[model samples]
Target: MVLSAVLLFGASSVTSLNGVFAQDSVDEISESVGDTVDNAASDISDAVTDEESESTTQEHGEMVHDDEGRLPGNIKIEREPTYKVGDDVQINATHMPGMEGAEGTVIAAFDTTAYEISYTPTDDSEPIENHRWIVQEEIAEAADQEDADAPFEVGDEVTVEAYHMPGMEGATATIDAVNETTVYLVDYIDTESGEEVINHKWVTEDELATLDGAEETAPATSESTTESSEDESESEESSSDEESGSESDSTPEENSDEESSEESTPEESSSQDSSSEETE
Candidate 1:
């Protein structure tokens, strides 16, 4: 009886130890799974925050030309503009890539409301902040809204119809500031790409300067000189041809007179010979 009791106690102790180890393993596995889930959730939250932050960062496309025509006719120049239409000026501002140091031709100028805005893109991508120079006419009013001519104040939310950059149109934007200065539409060559950018919008007077010694100015002057030289060359050629024609036409008459004089000399010589023979 004693032996059997001892054997039973040993078997019971082993089973208890096995149960404790199994419970510990289960607890450790549960803790590892919890940690993994927490980490995954944190990573997802961080990614979302990062995406939202990136959306608001100011980024633009290389080309943003839609809504780039003239401003409204009602918008007049409030003061004399520093640069006039058809003036070639150097760009001092870099509103887009490759704008600074580029040569621009002024196409239009008008004094109207300009705005700095922050907006979410229409495609629901990242938001853009502090975008410059979206004009008053570029904002699309809500259908029910009144007061079309009123300028927007800071913190006012409006929909942008201007495609100042890609995904900018139809975006809801908050006005950050307003300016009542003359804005110019211009054509410029991309110094980097050498491509022509036409009817670029909203460059303020402060952003332009006289194009003294700019890269394009030198080439234009050289071309003008080449044209002038060509004209002079053509004129000289024409004058020389006229002079040659006159000399040739006069040469024929002189030759005919010389031939007549030679024939008369021969006749005089024959008469002298006949007189000499009669004398002999």
Candidate 2:
């Protein structure tokens, strides 16, 4: 009986230890799963935050870097530009967001061969399309060429020396178009962000219009003139109507006077006849 009791006690102790071990294993597994879930959530949150930051930067027109970026050290200046320095003008460029149709003041002017180029950025970003106003001096190959006036033809590949935007420098770019004209540095308020942008380089002469000559301004002026003309026409019609009304009123008054004279004549004739009869 003693031997049997000792055996039973030993088996119960083993079962209890096994239950404890099983419970510990379950707890350890739960902790590991919880840590994995927390780490995954953190990673997802970070990715979302990064994407939002990039979107905000794009929305606010933050791509342009002005003189803080690379610029051509030895660009030729235009001695006489159609739009002189200090001239307030309208920008017609779509190089960046809010650049088109923005009011700008000319800061400097240059006579150069401007190029529109297409390139893949060094940052592995999306390929840029028809980026405007990269001057001949900003192209490494063109600057080393014998003829500075001879611009690269469309589809010609060249090395970009400009840092107008991130990843622009040292990237291989293809010329899309070329223009031999005056380029201007301008200060303008960004239409998207309402922020002042200073010393923005390379707005071509053809891409600028006088403040008063802007397409929007022209339409507004024309609309005002047409409104003024309509007002004058309305005034003239109103005056004509008044004059016609006065003439019509005078005709009625004249007819009334004639009728009264006719009535008085008859009465006067009758009175004369009665006086003659009385004398008789």
Model 1, span 1-280: residue lDDT tens: 9999999999999999999999999999999999999999999999999987676443432234533464543456545677888888998887577788999899878877788899988877677788778887788773335866578789999988876567777888999888867888888887776778788877888888988766567889999999999999999999999999999999989999999998899889999999999999
Estimate the overall C-alpha local distance difference test score of candidate 2.
0.86
132-211, model 2: which lDDT tens digit per residue?
Answer: 76898988887577886678898999999887677889999999998989888899988887888878877899989998
**Model 1, which residues run further than 4 Å from truth?**
1-62, 66-80, 141-149, 213-280
lDDT score, candidate 1: 0.80
User: Mind sharing the TM-score for model 1?
Assistant: 0.49
Clashing pairs in 2: none
What local lDDT score does residue 174 receive in model 1, on the 0 to 100 scale? 97
Cα-based RMSD of the predictions, in order?
A: 9.9, 12.6
